[model samples]
Target: MENDCSRFVQKCHKCQIHGDLIKVPPTEPNAMMSPWPFAAWGMYFIGPIEPDASNKHCFILVTKDYFTKWVEVASYSSVTKKVVTDFVRNNIICQFGIPESIITDNGANLNSHLMKEMCAQFQITHQNSTAY
Candidate 1:
């Protein structure tokens, strides 16, 4: 009887169309772990914000240490590869020492040749976030 009911449901077009949807994840979720403070950092750009007292500032570059949750931020008029590389060199590297790796979104400025060269010079691993 149970097998007959199962077969009946399987053969029912309306049941197949209107049945409860099964939710399956596309991929397994992995947690990011950092061994120590400033070991791994994530960097991203924010805005075309309203200019503040510093008139030249339009965009903000933000970096956060994965382990300690420490944040470093700087403002710039325009964001280029040079600006990003300089920020990583001056603010993050100089202030906290060299990080093992840096993660960033798939922005052209972050993934440019110049930025990659700069990271290579510092022996820091650069990784891009996966698109959803």
Candidate 2:
């Protein structure tokens, strides 16, 4: 019975399409080591969530330092390239100093031309993760 169920699931096209996506490499992933605090950072966007009353914030930008695990979050009503770049500039670069590298998912806002120019201007390496 278990074998039959497993075979059925493996052959189901809808199950494959709607299945949970794997975000990691099939083999062991290489560990990233940060040389110092605030040296490497990871950024992510969460939302279009239910808006709040205070500022009608529906989106959140979150960043974390690789070494220290220090997190910074900002709320926005709409996410755009300009919003993302300004967040990196004012919150990350200005407050914490330039980072060695930034890791982010390949979203349009994060991968925009303006974002590329900003990183080039600051000499910060930007890395995009494989889409899950």
Candidate 3:
């Protein structure tokens, strides 16, 4: 039994490799193509910064269009799902028209029920980021 196992390891190409162990599957490069402006957007939160702004706001919510690199920003004391939804509704949808997709990190405020419902209503694809 021991000899068979030893022979199997010797014949295995991966076992012969002298480098860092690869636990995850090798990933192929994927091109993220946005067909047009306002087609895709990515959202992020800046900080609960020292309330430096004139409005005494501490948090900054910013979203940028993937194609045009156009950005929309707003500041608030605290960020909630309501705040996120309102920002998307007013800044992105109302101003630039509905986007094809919105991608955000898997934040609670970003991936709320309200956001999903809004996306469904607008026919916008909402995706939470995954480790890639």
Residues 1-132 of candidate 3 have per-residue lDDT tens digits of 999998998898887795356786888997765789999999988887974688788899999998889989999988899999999999999999999999998889999999999999999999877844
RMSD to native for every prediction?
6.2, 7.2, 8.0
CA lDDT of every candidate: 0.89, 0.92, 0.90
Error of 1 at 82 (Å): 0.6
TM-scores for every candidate against the unseen true structure: 0.72, 0.74, 0.73
lDDT of 1 by residue, 20-117 (tens): 77774577777766888899999999988875545778889999999999999888888899999888988999999999999999999989998889
Q: Which of 1 and 3 is ahead in lDDT?
A: 3
Which candidate has the top score in lDDT?
2
Comparing 1 and 2 by lDDT, which wins?
2
TM-score ranking, high to low: 2, 3, 1
lDDT of candidate 2 over 7-120, digit per residue (tens): 998999998888777974588777866899998999989998874648899899999999999999999988999999999999999999999999999899999999899999
Query: Which model is ahead, 2 or 3, in terms of TM-score?
Result: 2
Count clashing residue pairs per candidate. Answer: 0, 0, 0
Better of 1 and 2 by TM-score: 2
lDDT of 2: 0.92
